[model samples]
Target: MSPTSDLLAAALAQSGFHPRLPQQRRLYEAAKAAIHQQRLGAGGKLPSSRDLARDLGMARNTVIAAFEQLAAEGYVVSSRGSGTYVADLQAHSASMRGVGATPQGRSTAPAATPSARLSRRGQELTSYAAGPQFEIQPFAPGDPDFSSFPFKLWQRLQNRVWREARNDLLDYGQSGGHLPLRQAITEYLRISRSVKVEVEQVMITAGTQQSLDLCAQLLADVGDTAWIEDPCYWGARRVFQARELKLRPITVDSDGIAIAAADLATKPRLIYVTPSHQYPTGAVMSLARRRELLDVAVRKDAWILEDDYDSEFRYTGRPLAALQGLDHDDRVLYMGTFSKVLYPGIKVGYLVVPPALIPAFRSALYDLQRPGQLTVQATLADFITLGHFTAHVRKIRQTYGARRELLRHMLAQKLPRSVTISREESGLHLVIELPDQVDDMALAQQAAMQGISVKALSTYYLKPPIRRGLLVGYAYCTPEQITDYGRLLGTIIAAEAAA
Candidate 1:
């Protein structure tokens, strides 16, 4: 038989339309008809493993196995050095057609009912949306210039870890993460952030998002109120909302989240704050406000979630001590992530819970979550203990600080008279307040068209529209890119203002 015929026969047998195996014979017969009817034809390569896998909702290996089986049956022929090909089975086509025949002509099958498609609850969440084409610029908040990351050093460490890893390293690691990593984190946080916690108090998580989710579950019940900053992190709001916890927006000024009469009125179960540098509005919580917040948490019997994100990149004098350091009442639940200092893809973060909560927190994490790769964690711990992590952060801090200055200078020179930049002291991002008349959403969309991605501050608010502004990040952008991004953003703002 020719290769085409041989392939056709093999495909038929592989599909299982044989005289035996009655359970799947109907499907096999149907598939055979589709092939004969030119629905699947000669000279056409079989569907890719992925496509077949999807169609059958089976693993790719299964489809590949079936194809191999067909080749073995001599219905399909495998070329000595080429891919499998259909056998020209013209001789048996007529006979095979009769096997599945009905009096009407060919047996017809019932159509499959469509299954419901799953979707995420709200509108598709993205940092930027499609819009006008602006100049290619870097405006994404909190994205460090990935190009500056020590790829060579990281690869060397990764290679070393992989070479040294035992067979056990391939298995599921401790849910609390690799022990050495936890110890390294404990030591580092104690020395750097002044956090008083042992390795037992720390729980490794898949970065800040997972840490926040775990915290929300552990600390608050459904319907419990969680106070977030007015111009807070949108991601945290999403996390809170997903857990069905009520999010109350507390107003923020130069001193961070204002925890006064209004915050007390909400009777929040947990208060989430980015004390080191507030999100969107880059205000650091003053010493007085931090003290007051700790006191309120104690008085109200509420837990304070200190999201000490981006504290490592403080450009000014020494970074402020974490609120966790000052909390004598054990009210602070500290969260930190390597995403800001390193790459987000690392997915390593630590949550420092009060001593009382450690046991329960570890148990919850153990029961509900699986640990990340053991080798990665162990290697990272070695990196930190060896001082590479500190050195990398120090180098990047200077690079980002210079980039921030360039951005600030460009903004001052190019931004419209009506727009004002706020809180440039310490963080990867700065906020630019726009006029009330300009719609931030429209401006963001317009800027996106110019190939620039800028965020609108109004989107972060839960209640009480606070400030209309753009949260521009310069960390990932180079000095040149920062200048260009600022200019593009200024142009967009100016055009919008003129309009």
Candidate 2:
């Protein structure tokens, strides 16, 4: 569709437009929508009132009145003999200056000028998009069924927090986070993950990625070396890279993060591991490796950042206790988020560190960002304290467990026996290893064309010997959808394999 009419239809689709409305108001909304979407650019001529009415099936008089109202509001100008035209947006106000950005976030404004060049690091960061967009195509990894969250309960909790708000809540919160939320988290972690910590050690932040950023800022220097699991969560690795840390990708096996003698020789400044459940690969770190890692950190005087994301969604045997729970030297900083458990919108995550790091972390937090989202933190504290959070986690864990099984069953029935499947005890996704001859990148692109969004396993590697596979997430879709998706994936893989 042409941009103008297309945007108009989209805007109208989002509206509760009523014919009973005063004619002027209806026209005003239509004109404003068109302008806001930049479907009608500055000085772009709009259809005549009669033509607009006929096209939209509205009253001609109503369109005329709306046009008059828009003119009065400086949205459009009605020429003496010509049709109405959108006002010069840049001339109107700051709000109207860039209504024509394309879907990719590229500005559609012809008059817009380029800004100054970005810094070297900014340019480097933008050279390639580093992480998943979480686009909800079939088999996309790491996303949960966000729609299943109990919004009514959340709404009630939010109302309670706001209703009880005193004057102190109006100011910026303490940089470390809300104390009550920290206390709640401290209690929860001690019971659930077996991490022993006082409330003072819990530093609430936005989420896992922010937690990683904080670790980079507070613990390590720009050129310091960080040893991450080879096929690590790309998002966290990118955070460390953004802080200009040199990354060393250590191999991961069944025991998780294979720290070799050579790795010890590196004397890494920081070590990042997903010990509860290694990301993408789903390898749970063994107790032996966990102990070895803790010992290495103590010997090397290195900091360990434990990412416990998705550890709450285990469907198999009881999850292994967090690596931080095993640390005796106070070297590991444990970070966990409510994003996977409750929902991503909460933006609430906490860091449990050594008592000595608390002051530095709290100070660095304010330096990086001003204290914000106090109300959200407060509501989440109530949700956790009242046991709603645990209840929700239990319910969704069962649902995801069933979905995971359905996925496995379907893949087994439909796919070739040569497809090597690796299933682990927990996490949202599984690794499906493809044959060496099959180009994983090409397969991923082709699968995307067929409405799947799984990532090629080769893309996760930063060292020699890339692993050829696909990471398929089974947590979000229904069992029926999983079966259908499996059928489609099997067909796609069959065709790709033959070629």
Candidate 3:
């Protein structure tokens, strides 16, 4: 078939014709849209009725009837012995435009550029640096090993969900998510992370990004103070900025956020922290610091947004108990995502809110995002109850630990001792600190050219006084790739330093 015929065939097959509409009418509408959109250009010859009918799995008569209608409507022209050609509508289109009328003769308003149409808030939100394009390369940060996932088992569970599907499974789920899934998450968090929560306080989100968006919207108002950890997760930062929250970057030290006495004068409405394993820089918040922050939150009447992302992959000592567990005032909004532990495509995360705010958060989530994925949630619940979730976590922790060691070893052997590698005991990536004079951004670009994916640590900071380093991820890369790429990256870093 010709390209035009193939395009039309795809259009016809996927146009989602209404059940009540006859096939001929559907075909006529689809064809008219193609012509009006100029996809079928002027004088473009259409396929023969017989060819079109075979391609679309319709009767030849149906195709002929549709074609006749289109020609009658001046969308096409049929010749004596030649194929039908798309009619030239340039003159008609120009005439309509001149009179400020659309092809359907509706009076149209003046067209405005996208920037002009957007609100001031929209422009500010768009101006922030959206993270990388998520390319899968040597050391792209926070990416899990997709090949290691048990797809067959996951498929079997999903198949079972559909096989025994109920009306509730197909319909819109509760704003708080599938009850069983929420219960499962509650149990898991209580045992694994020491997150004290009931199923009623749990709300399912698409991911941490959605959870952040919801919290920013519901917990705080526009222009209200939001304290975010310096050099924080860009995703959370973006969410707060989008909600027009006034962000105060709190400096992070050896123990998570170093809250100074002066810094607490202007009380914040919300406090965002990754106390488990800080992003880019993997500083586990000390127990003392956790208690201090909790006390501060209570004193200031602030809500602490504890993002326990990647807490399951701790490789040394033990995974620290979540900061939420220490909250006596129930002011902490604990968030966790399956993206880091499972795969990113799962698109499932949970936020454990305070009991009092449950109704507000649930209603707001439903009204704003309309969260639904009951089938996936059901299968995930089954996977957890069957002990597959913990098993998977154990299996990947060993694999990632090995990869992390190999990459560290390779880089240590190749790079100079002057380059200081962070000794954080957990998380997917490691930060290699550089001298103040070395340009980490330029080094990152040069490493990318060599096919080594690493993020510049300087870029993570919200304000200046930034530390210079590169975040090299080991969770996604295999031993062989890590060894090879680590050597190349080491050489690149050494050269950059010498220059």
Candidate 4:
């Protein structure tokens, strides 16, 4: 197959293209993924729009819509007699990449890899390539047990939604999202996370990554700096860096996201933090630090993107109220996801911005993503309203809590002297800090080869302290599986230590 067709096939398989998805969306996703990952290169000529649409079995208008969107986003350009081509992003936008390409029929030598043909920004993104891996093996961070999800109930809800599905429900929804789902989210946040927001302030997103991208795009400009906790969620870092924003990796302490004396001197346009339960390390940002961040945001006139990631699964004394709750001023942008609480396939996440910012947020989001599928949103709202969402969280919390304890016990018994267990108060994952001499990445690879999906603490660090360790997730595995994996991991560590 041609490279363009190959990319569509990849997207179809990777995204599990459902007939329910709009044809325009499928094309857009495939093209974006292809371009961003450099599977499609710069200056390459596109097949005639009509021919391509026919090949994909999509209506011609659907393909036109996709191309128009891509062009608007600076991904492609059309000429009067030369035909359509990928935008030479570098030639037009300095900070943008993946747009400009070598024209077809040109005699210039080809770049070695897709990455080489990309813009500087695009090449940087490939450096942190997190290839897809969803193995349910021991210690895989963020891999939840989907088998335990109430798929039957979900199917029934989906069935009910489709039976009553209205044509308008499938079209571009209110840029802010389906109203009922937003209301449900508002109510849930009020009681559960102490987050206060009206339905108008909450915007539905595809995932946390999309939310981050929106925050980066709308709040900050290219080359503007943003502060993220060092050893942070790699996904967030990727989004910010891809936008050509200068990322300042602030160090994290036991208190969480400690702003250093040096860091204070640098002006930031945006600040991204996981204040509820910090990723990888699992450290909860102290109330005092939360206040400090809020004050800093207010004083600096910077936007704070609080990724309340995995806060729902907190296995602690009533989960801490979200950092957004403490912000008196409108500087904080609160992000929450249904992926962790419910399941990733739900593809529903929401953002709460300040009231004054809602109109702009809605407009920008609609232009950027044109996101909808509200019939699914309605089903989610019904599920939340009927209490299944809460009940499932309660049940999963208890189950994951037990698994956490089991993993903790096993690690202490198996590798007590060799590793340090830090931050066990919240979230689905824990850190077992290893010796400085051990190479975490190599060890993790060995574990994976032995059928364990593990993450190295070193991989998360963009700045110093840069400790070596393993991140073991307990939410998905059974107690027995934890023990078995713990022993296997310990064995690997012991050998690494010896080496």
* Highest-lDDT candidate: 3
**Candidate 3 lDDT for residue 409:** 90
TM-score of each: 0.73, 0.76, 0.79, 0.77
Global fold similarity of model 4 (TM-score): 0.77
Q: For candidate 4, lDDT tens digit of each residue in 15-45?
A: 5665567879778777867776766777777
Relative to the true structure, candidate 2 reaches a TM of: 0.76
Ranked by lDDT, the better of candidates 1 and 3 is 3
lDDT of 3 by residue, 1-499 (tens): 7787687777767746453589899888888888878899876788999898888888999999999988776677676466677766654444335543333333432233234445678877777756558568889888899989999999999999999967788766756899989999999999989989989999999999999999999889989999999989989988898898999999998788999876888789999999988876888889999999999999999999999989999887778889988888999999999998899889999999999999999998888887888899999999999999999999999999998889889888877767888898789999998988899999999999988889999999988846899999889887889989999999998887777
Weakest lDDT window of 10 consecutive positions for candidate 3: 104-113
How do all the candidates rank in terms of TM-score, highest first?
3, 4, 2, 1
- Output candidate 1 Cα RMSD: 12.1
Clash count list over all predictions: 26, 0, 0, 8
lDDT comparison, 2 vs 3, better candidate: 3
Model 2: how far residue 357 lies from native, Å: 0.6
Per-residue C-alpha lDDT of model 1 across residues 1-499, encoded as one tens digit per residue? 4443344345545643564643234333444455456555544555454565555555667656665655444334444334444433442333244432222233221111111111233333222334444443578777777888888988898899899857867766654778888999999888888898988888988888888899899889989999899988877887887777888889898888886676687778889999988886888899999999998888888899999888998888888889999999899999999898888888889899998998888888777777657788877888898999999999999998888788878888877778888855788888889888889988888888877788888887877566788888888887777777788788778778777
Minimum summed lDDT over a 10-residue window in model 4 is located at 107-116
RMSD to native for every prediction? 12.1, 8.7, 9.6, 10.5
lDDT of 1: 0.75
Q: What is the C-alpha lDDT of each candidate?
A: 0.75, 0.80, 0.86, 0.81
lDDT of 2 by residue, 332-413 (tens): 9999998888777778888888999988888888777676788888888888899898899899999998888888877777
